[model samples]
Target: MVLGVLGALLVPSLSSPASAAGDATVVVRGTDLPVGGPIELSYVGCARLYERTAEVPQPFVGLGPDQAPAGERSLRYDLAGGTALGSLSYARSMASTTTSGLSVQAPRGAAGVAWVGYQEPADFGTTTYWFGRADVSAPAGAWTSVETTGLTYTWSRYDMATRRAVGGATAAPSTLAAMIAERGDGPGFRTVGFGCDGNRFALDALRVGDATGTTTYDLEGLTTTTVMAARPAPRGTVLTGVLRDGSGEQVVRGTLVLERQVAGGWETVQVVPAEAVDATVTVAPEQTTTYRWRFADRPLAEGSVSEPTTVTVAPGQETSQEPTQQPTRQPAQR
Candidate 1:
């Protein structure tokens, strides 16, 4: 895997041209190029990155007609739609403050980017280069990530109103998995749903405009659902919330549900069916609990749930919420 801020150019072979030219001389060409989109960055490196750039740099080629050795990996193309090259920036942050700037031809899109830097698989010295489509435009927002190989980039359509990233950075499959170590790809970019991964993150508040953003994924690392039977002696032993109608009638056997934030995203932890009285949720004690649940999917949207309830099991507390506390035996005085 070659790491780099700028995508190296590609070599023109008998089957491939030096550039992808089209009838429209508008600049970046090709339907694949994300036009009027945001900016995204990724890193890729190999032996070739260290190579000194002469007056001009060579372009990296993609999987060509020529095949590599059976065991070796082939150099594939890394590009945005219309063969858009990446936009790079460097910055520093401290005490929650950030200072940053970008270095590229076009501030946002491919308007100024003319080259894509490519390196040999594993070996950076074996590099190639390819110019981008002339019509390449500028990116709106920027998303950048650095890896062992190089820095990754993402340019997106910025929601000028909320000042958040709504569009996605075109990323490789490996990139997604690496972002969420233990996550699996499901429906709606479910692999790395809305969350932070110490990278240029695309954040949103889950609005109706963001149809592609609202992803549904199964949460991992649930460990176990410890049960704490309810008891009358203790006002409450099992963590729970009451469900009722506008009239305030005891909603017996209605439903209970749990949502958990994991792997840089939120997912359903538990879902109690309708007509189920209270719910007995099991979880290890932790801080900063952020989750949401659906009560009465029936649309009445009646009762409001208790703000994400958190519990801290003391040192010797019984797993089950018993009415009385167990006797504590002090260690023998040394």
Candidate 2:
């Protein structure tokens, strides 16, 4: 189940992308990129996040392939549609503020963006809103890149007099280049955000370009899986486990807990530090036991657990009389 968000603040839907308040209401840190940059992904409406899983595919080519071997995870939002609507958005905070508030910048022709599903462009300020939408650039399950140099989009400006967005009058369809030309730049483009209001989709590799340079944000979470070296071996058989990151690379940081299934829940058997890229451990059980690795949550990576691997002791194998080393008993850390 997806983590539930409080409040039922209704915003404009996809049909009227530029009618009122923007989608993102709860702004929080999602995850950090490998490039040492923070990606603050805000969830809009009833959006539910589905992290690293084989069911949903990531947008990148060599990353999250839509086939077998689940690739890297994508920042996905699954909307139930009808009354339950959802979207994913990101905003650049003002450079001078201490908080993560939105920033206001002058319109620039160098501004460009890319998404996977329905895109909604929003401009937020104090009692000021400007919403716009363009033709669907990409299909349902693909990535689309748009250079704001010459792209024309239908825009709707908010009218304080009537307390609503006035379309076909004060605001008309305009291109990104034309907006910058008319405004002539200088702190008017406050709070620029883009998102999708589709049923189920993902957003990844957000490359936003400006006059200075372009930064690509690869939004993802950590993933872990474990396997037993020998199954159905003798009572003294050794068990080993391997750990990896989201990109299928060996995990070289943090600690992993070795858990064994108990009557109530899983119990921590050993606390192993991931000194090397792939963490390996050896354990010998007297009877058949099921085990898995549990990775704790960190600032850069969310917590994850591996599939269960049960090792059955050979029925007629001669049992060793030597006593096994006692494992330190403790609860599984988050």
Candidate 3:
């Protein structure tokens, strides 16, 4: 079932089969969306997966000033070279799932992509359902606003185990209640993503709402640091360094990749798991060396690289004390 995002709240009518009793409408306007906050974004590449909690003005490959829709800021995606998918979503925290809706503005010149509605299953698996798709075509450089309701059983049934489409039908919603039903106890709607074949698009004013007071999922920010105790140390001396977050918090999860400056570029030398936040490492160098750390991305934080920390290894020196020869034995023999 699909629900509309109009400002006016509508009561569920008994005349339609899709609309059940005790159904009420809730709306989240585009202007109400948060700015510079955490957003649940997932990007699937042909070869790998990129998922993280990102802030506003997220980076994309082909996005420019003209591509931004008529809004303060938008979620921009640039897809090229292969099939890619990017999505933003929110799931209800309550025991039951609530029907939510979203509105996105896309540029007219965009092609080979469509806005999609999806449902998240209750099972602790990564499977999701694509219930519907909307073609967002507009004039060159113009913006087209497309809105969709939360999806229900009206969409196709997908088999998670086989990763194939089972048997189900896709139809438009006829009743308001059916679209707003919180199928929380069962597999229900959760997130929305774009299905595209190499295209660039912008999304703005994405608002999610339900009958109960549920806030939209916002993206969070992360920080990283790289430090060394001594820059110039004696040859063969072990250089020690520490990694931390912006708030001086230790990051004990994910992988920290250690890299060294090479002739042309940086080369990875070590891949360490972040078992603690105040993680430290020791590196012994034969000559002058430059090092840095690359923090892996987490579900709620974006990955980052630390600034290069150069350590100079000074020449070795002999101690003042010298070894004594067997002078006494030589004198006795003479």
lDDT for each of the candidates? 0.26, 0.39, 0.39
For model 3, residues 227-323, the per-residue Cα lDDT tens digits are 5443333423333446666556665454566667989997766665554643345566666678776665542234577777776656773322111
Task: Give me the candidate number with maximum TM-score.
Answer: 2
The residue-level lDDT of candidate 3 at 199 comes to 46
Task: Specify the poorest-scoring 10-residue window by lDDT in model 1.
Answer: 187-196
**Tens-digit per-residue lDDT, 1-334, candidate 2:** 1321212212231111111232222112234332212222333221111121223222221223242122244444343331121222222321111111121111111121221111123433233434443432234343434333344556555443344545554446676445545643212121122333334444444433333333444444555444334333344545555666655665546566777898999977776665474445555656777888777765335567777777566677456422244455453342
Stretch of 10 with least lDDT, candidate 3: 325-334
TM-score of each: 0.20, 0.39, 0.36
Segments in model 3 whose C-alpha atoms lie over 4 Å from true places: 1-39, 43-75, 81-84, 88-108, 111-146, 150-154, 168-185, 195-197, 214-334
Instruction: Arrange candidates by TM-score, descending.
Output: 2, 3, 1
Residue range 1-334, candidate 1, lDDT tens digits: 1122332222221111101222111111111122222222223221122222221212221111122211111112223222222322211100110111122211132322222222112322333211111111223333221111112322222222332334552234232223223232111110001111111112111101121121111101101121223222343334444555533444433554555556876555555543445554444423434444435322112334445543445566544432123223321111
> Which of candidates 1 and 2 reaches a greater lDDT?
2
